[model samples]
Target: MASYHRVLEVFDRSVQDKTLECAYDLDPWDILIDDERWTGKIRLFGFVDIFFLICYSGEERFEKGIIIYKDNDSVRIILERARKNTTEYVVNRDALENEEIPKSYFSFEDDKGGLNYQILGLGHPIGLSTNYDPGSLKQYKIKIRRSDDLVTRKRMQRGLKQHTLIDLMLDVVRLGIITSAELISKVVTMTVAGSATDDLARKYLQVLSGGQPGTPGLSRDRM
Candidate 1:
């Protein structure tokens, strides 16, 4: 067995200000072993979602969270996680640049015939650029897999329904159909009336309602 180590560096910027607010260096994370493959699902912010399945035969390393795939004789199968109701296969740059690599290795099939495991990637605070220069800085990513079954699929569907409800509520507020204060009050009241454990949700509502004082109305223009 070949031992591999990898590292990843992440840069986080505020979408509102477009300013680099934080940076992180994560080290000694997970490694992809030879002949082992995995698949998994990701639920973010209760709305953003992705379902993926992958199979690979390779040895890779992470050093301080920077990504480095050491073995040239590696093959990977990747299913692009779906977002906004779109999904596809993901091709690694290495596979694209190397003529020896065949595109079929990364192909994705919708049929549930193969291994269905969850591969959970390490989560960092930054979004990486697809066109990044690897020579100047190394990039690292992680994947986690779980067995895909009817139960997990149903859970993901439920999450999507809830996310849609929340989005509709926010849209109403954005369109000025309802005041931010009204929305905040409703959320706070419902939360307080039901489960008091969701302090984060309450705080988020407060932030939305307590915008800069004297602002005329809730407008997506300001967001």
Candidate 2:
């Protein structure tokens, strides 16, 4: 199993600069491994949303999305694998249904008469306050408001970077414990041999608890 101390030492070395910019403390190691909440959730979705008129929703394209693998080391491995698997989203009409979109927030009235009788998109009756199924448009309003915040985007971006870091950490953990311990040892430690055979099997549990590195490819367990 990879030890926390072992990986932390390596991470500290990689992010040796101590100031990661986005970090309020300006410390490179501000990214904490002991965070009780999973930072991955924030990265799974973008901070700001774009609202659009009924005109268009763009063409079909491959987009990045998130998928959870496991709560531990395997989650990291699967996330790493997924970075290569961009998802396909179709731009069909149904795709534009009521969901809050990116960068297209505005009231789009269809000008049938080009006057007071102009129709709202998808038969939304004219109203002072939104009294729709979403109820007061509270969620959409919040999404738009939150998305507009600069700090919100910063948090989202940082969360994404860490998400990928966690993935690489998972792969390193798996290699050092499950798939190719011998391979990783070549880079970090061949001197990492177990004192007892019983110690070798117990290594995986330790790796499972491993977290993201402060620097890109550094590991909590070093290699």
Number of the top-ranking candidate, with TM-score as the measure: 1
Least accurate 10 contiguous residues by lDDT in model 2: 47-56
Q: Write the per-residue lDDT of candidate 1 for residues 176-199, one digit (tens) a residue.
A: 656977887666764468443233
> What lDDT would candidate 1 get against the real structure?
0.26
| Residue-pair clashes, model 1 | 34
Considering every candidate listed, which one attains the maximal lDDT? 1
Location of the lowest summed lDDT over 10 successive residues in candidate 1: 77-86
Predicted candidate 2 versus true structure: per-residue lDDT over 1-223, tens digit per residue: 3322222232221112221212121111212212222222111221111111111112312122111111222222322322311112111234356455421112222223422111111111111111122111111111111123468445533322322334444544543534555545442432355233233222221122223432122112312
Off-target runs (Cα >4 Å) in candidate 1 are 1-111, 117-133, 136-223
lDDT of 2 at 73: 27
